[model samples]
Target: MPNVKSAEKRMRTNEVRAERNRQFRSRLRTALKKVRAATTAADATPAFREAASLLDRAARKRIIHPNKAARAKSRLTVKIAALG
Candidate 1:
């Protein structure tokens, strides 16, 4: 219901960004799950690295809070260590 041309364009931009963010968030969740799902420390190592990278990226882009990313990474490390 945007009557103004600029508002209409903004709405389109918002929609595009929302979809892109959703995809990125989904990937982040999948990466975290991959790390958590690994039962062995060896298997978890690689997944942890990938998940850590995604977490940092998400934090950098403000998709997630930096502290939240750090906390998740810490928890994953603990989980992997417990698997050891």
Candidate 2:
């Protein structure tokens, strides 16, 4: 549907970026799920750390808001602590 050359290029770039952003978002979600599923203290610690890192990366890349990242990290930390 792109009629102009620049428009076509932009469309292609958009598609690529969209895929990359989707992958990053999915990865973050998976990490969060892992943290949520953690039943043991040892299991939860690394999962929480990984989720925090993923949240930070997503926020830095503008996939999610900074405050949202902080909130997620806080909740995950609380869950891990409550495991004890």
Candidate 3:
């Protein structure tokens, strides 16, 4: 549908970026789930670490808001603490 060459290229790049962002978001959700599903502090510790790292990366990349990342990390930490 793009009528110009540059427009066509932009469309292609946008599609690729959208797909990549989708995959990254999916992975981030999985990481969050892993942390929440953890039954023990020992298990949650590592899961939280990985999830926190992913959240930080996502925030830095503007995939998710920085405040959201901080809130998620704080809630997960509280949940992990409650497990102990």
Better of 2 and 3 by TM-score: 3
Best-fitting candidate, scored by lDDT = 3
Name the better of 1 and 3 by lDDT.
Answer: 3
TM-score of 2: 0.93
Deviation from truth (RMSD, Å), model 3:
0.6
Please give the lDDT score at residue 7 for candidate 2.
100
Better of 1 and 3 by TM-score: 3
Candidates ranked, most accurate by TM-score first: 3, 1, 2
Q: In model 2, what is the error at residue 11, expressed in angstroms?
A: 0.7
> Which ranking of candidates, highest lDDT first?
3, 1, 2
Instruction: Output the number of the TM-score-best candidate.
Output: 3
- Model 1 lDDT per residue over 1-84, tens place: 989999999999999999999999999999999998898999999999999999999999999999999999999989998999
Give each model a TM-score. Answer: 0.95, 0.93, 0.96
| Candidate 3 residue spans exceeding 4 A from truth | none
- Colliding pairs, model 3: none
